[model samples]
Target: MDILQELRYRGLIHQLTDEEGLTKKLSEEPVVLYAGFDPTADSLHIGHLLPILCLKRFQMAGHLPVALVGGGTGLIGDPSGRSTERSLNTSDVVEEWTDKLRGQLSQFLDFESTVNPARMANNYSWLGELNVITFLRDIGKNFSVNYMLAKDSVDSRLSNGISFTEFSYMILQAYDFFRMNSDINCSLQVGGSDQWGNITAGLELIGKSTGNKAFGLTMPLVIKSDGTKFGKTAGGAVWLDAEKTSPYQFYQFWINTDDNDVVTFLKYFTFLTREQIAELEEQVKLSPEKREAQRVLARVMTELVHGEDAALSAIKISEVLFSGNVETLSGREIEEAFKDVPSTELSGNEEIGLVDLLIAVKAAPSKRQARQDIESGAVSLNGIKVSDVEKVLQSSDRMEGRYIVIRRGKRNYYLAKFV
Candidate 1:
């Protein structure tokens, strides 16, 4: 199937400037397309994956894809999706985050393709060096105040009061599209649905300035069936950076996908063929208890972002934790699997009685309860059931010589650290 047809089938297209014209252009030749990501944070979260993957989709179709980091606009902050004004970061911080975003984008796109390698561009290169006088006289003149204010991005922020810096963001973004079009002959811009206004402004700039035709397309905002944001968990935003959110955590996030949303998420996130997805959909209908679709989504996403080794490790951790055989997991896997569980740290390496260890880790409330729980076979140390109340846990008993996994019951887990 054609790229646009596939995207449509997957429900990726939200708003298109001219579907007929863009389809014709795409069919005739490889169209150069670009997507902009602002360095709002040091790492891109799961929310940013859709656009990054969209760029990859275009590249896989033999088209040139440019991943644009919004180093310039990031400094000013886009008022597209905010209820209030954004806190501005220093130029140095923005630059640092910009480099990090470029690195992350590099992972998803093919930079070494001999035929149509992906390209990276930072708007700061052009936007940073732009002369204010020239910008006002040349680029600023193309956007009238009325036109800028009418845009959804600017209009939505009128009541809350957007700063001149952010108010001028539309023009700045328009200038970005114009510059890329002039430099690389980029003819298409794709972004989330929220970027539709800013995108059209760029098309306007390109049309009026160079009189060249450029198209705009946007993907729908990802939302959950439960009326909550898609990429959020109880902990906070699901970050793509492993340091912020571990591979295990990332995998679990997708693994917990709602049955109602699993098929939709698979379509949005994975490159699995339509038939493969259809089979998974059939499983979802026949046996919701199996959660096969959720597993596939988790595996595909975890492997895509964190690599196969991390994905496999996460899967093993999940299996071991489920089977109550976490002793097979490494120290790192143990930490990741129970990272969210209650934990306690005891200073120095010393042999602590099993009853005391349970109390220290707060797995048991009192000494009597600890002993009763242990004697009743309700306690386990590192996955082995411990019925001996006098069992002493020493340095040798620690997982990786540091951690002691304590399980009070079937699912309740706690961690004790010897420092």
Candidate 2:
């Protein structure tokens, strides 16, 4: 199937300009396509996954994928989806973020491909050197004030405020396309639905400045069935950086996908065949309790973003936690599993009674309650029921020589770390 048809089947195509022209261009030759990522944060979150994966999809289909890092335009934020203007970051901060973005992007594309290696470009290479005169006369002249104000990005911001710096972002982005076309022979730009205006502006500039045909495509913004935004949890945005969001948490984010949304996400994110997705859809309908679809989604997404080892670890952690088999976890796995669970630190590895340890970790309300819970078999130490109020916990009870897991009832868990 053609790349466009594949994306259409996956529900990835949101807005496309000159579909026939782009279809012909892609079919005729290995058309070079580019997508830009602004360094707004040091890490790209799950929200950025669609476009990054889109670039990979094109590359796998024998097209040259150019990942553009917007070090230049990031200095002046794009007013596409925001109601308020962005606070400008220092040049040092933007440069630092740009480097991080570049590194994260590199992991997604096969730059070492002998057939068609991916290319990485930064707009700062050209935009930083542009002078006010050249920017205004050469690029800014192409855009009319009336036409600019009519854009959704500008019109939405006009009520409260919109700075010239951000208003002129469309021109800078258009120049990026013009430059990419002139230098790298890039013919297409892809971005999120909110970037429709800027993308079309780039196409217009390329048409007028170079008198060449260029194409723009946008992907739909992800939304959850619950009507809340996707990629956001109670903690915050699910970051692609493992350090910011651990592999386990990232895996859990997909594992807990709403029943109404899982099948669609499988189609959108994974490279699963239509037949495979249809099978999963059938599973969803027949046995929603099995959650096979959610599990597959979590595994595929975790492996794609964090690598096989991390994904395996995440799966192991999830399984252990689900089965309440805390004792089976390794030291590192225990830490990853209980990272967010309520925890207390022990100053030293001291032998203490189970009830005393429970009191120390606040797993129980008090020593009296701890003893009562222990006697009632309502408390467990490291996945083993502790019924003896006098049962003592020794150093041998510690998993990994440092950590112990305590449970109050079936659900409440506490982590005790010995120094």
Candidate 3:
């Protein structure tokens, strides 16, 4: 498929300026495109995946992708789509976050390739050196307060009050785009729909200063069928970082997608062709009993983010845990499978007793609750139902000599480490 057609088929194209013109322009030679990521948090959540994925797509099509890290802009948080004034993060905090964000982004874009390899740039490099006077005289003159206020970022904040720091964010982002456009010959910027105003400002800067044109494209914010935000589950933001959000939890998050929302998500997130997605949708509609679509969504994302091995292990752990067939699973598999789930690594301490293990892991609310669960056949240790009121802790029972996977019925695996 052509670039435009593939983007359309994968449901990656949101809003692009002059699609045909841009497509025609891109067809001739390799071009440069950019997407900026704000280090607002320590980890990049699924919300950050769209732009990163777009960068991958662009690079795959023989274009260079500049993944811009917002070390500078992050200090003055972008007010776009925010309901209230943001609590500005400390410079040190943001810098720390920026480094981690760069690492997470590295997992998405191919930076080691000899051809069209992705490049990482930080806006802080240029933005830090600019004097206030030069900034105002050079780039700031092009954007008026009236014009900035007219934009949506400033519009929604007219009542809540927009700070000068926040107001200047557009200029900073524009400068980043300008720097990329000038230094790297990067002419395309991609972001979420909310970034239209800031992205347009960058285009205006290019037109005014260099008399060049740039393009902006965005992907729709992932949202649920109920109009609620996506990438959130009972445990919280479905982070790509396993430490923040476990693989088991992440897999379950996708597997539990509402019947109505799975198809839309498959279109938005997965690289499946139109026919493949259509088939999944058809299965959901015709055979609602079989959840083929949700399963595919879970597997595709799991494999993309984690890897085939991780996804398989997560699936195995999930099947064993959910299927209530613990006998088939080894102790090592239990720990590997529940790595992302809530776990407490115990040391090989012969002094630690089973009662302390259950309470320490919070599998039981109290000693009495622990006794109750053990007696009710609901508690099992290493796949064996344990009813011994005074089961002694043994170094040998410790799976892998330091841990044991305890389960409460068909689900909820808790790990206890003997220290």
Candidate 4:
């Protein structure tokens, strides 16, 4: 299938400007397209993946992709999707975050491809040097106050009192598209659905300035069927940085996808073909209990972000915990597996009685209850039934000599960490 067909098949097209024109442009040559990612935080999260992957899709189809890091605009936050104003960051902080985003983006695009190698650009290089007179006269002259005010990004914020800094964000972004079109012959710009106004502004600027025909495409913002925001866990946003959200946690996030949303997410997030996704959709219809679709989504997404080894390890940890075989997990895996579980820290590696250990970890309310639970085989330590009330937990009982996995009943889990 063609690139457009593939994207259409995946339901990725949200808004496309001059589609017929773009189709002709794409067919004649490998059109250069660009997407901008502003570094609002130290790391990119799952929210950024759709466009990142879109850029990858374009690249794979023999087009050149430019991943633009909005170092310039990061300093001036876009008001497109915000009800409130953004706190401006210092140049040093924005630069630091910009570098981090640049590196993260590098992971997705193939810069080494001999035919159509991906390119990276930081808008700060140009925007920083742009003089006020040049910006106002040369670029800003093309936009009318009425036209700018009419944009959804600006209109929505009028009630909330949008700041001038943010109001001018559209122009800055337009300048970016114009700059890319001028320098690199970039004809297409893609972003989330919220960016339509800003994107069209860029197209307008390009048309007025260089008389060049530029295109804009936006992907639908990912949201769950339950009406909650996507890419969010109870902890916070699911970050691309493993340090922020571990591979296991990332895997679990997708693994827990609602049955109603899995197939759509599979279409949105993965490169899995229509037939493969169709098969998974059928599996979901036949055996929702198996969660085969969710597992595949988690595995593919985790491997894409974290790597094959981490994905496999996360899968193993999930399986081990699900099957009540916690003894097989390594210390790291155990920590990841029980990251959100209640934990008690032991000061040192001291041999403690099973009842006392259970009480200390709060797995049991008291010695009497602890013993009752242990004797009833309702408590297990490290995946083994510890029915002996007199059993003592020593260094031998610890997994990796540092931690013990305590399970009380079928579902409750606690972690005992020996400091």
Model 2 worst lDDT window (10 residues) = 347-356
| TM-score, model 4 to reference | 0.97
Off by over 4 Å in 1: none
Top of the candidates by lDDT: 4
Q: Which one wins by lDDT: 1 or 4?
A: 4
Write one digit per residue (lDDT tens) for candidate 1, span 214-289.
9999999998998888899899999999989999999999999999999999999999999999999999999999
lDDT of 4 by residue, 200-244 (tens): 999999998888899999999888999999988789999999889
Candidate 3: lDDT of 325?
59
State every prediction's TM-score relative to the real structure: 0.98, 0.97, 0.89, 0.97
Q: Compose the digit string of candidate 2's lDDT tens values, residues 1-419.
A: 59999999999999999899899988999989999999999999999999999999999999999999999999999999999999999989999999999999999999999999999999999999999999999898898999899999999999999998999999999999999999989999999999999999998899889899889999999999989999999989999999899999999999999899998899889999999999999999999999999999999999999999999999999988778888888888888888888999986648888888898888888899988898888987788887999888788888888888998888899999999
Give a tens-digit lDDT track for model 3, residues 54-157. 88888888889989999989888999998688898999999999999999889888999998799999999998899999999999999988999999988998
Off by over 4 Å in 4: none
Scored by TM-score, the top model is 1
Candidate 3 local lDDT, residue 306: 81
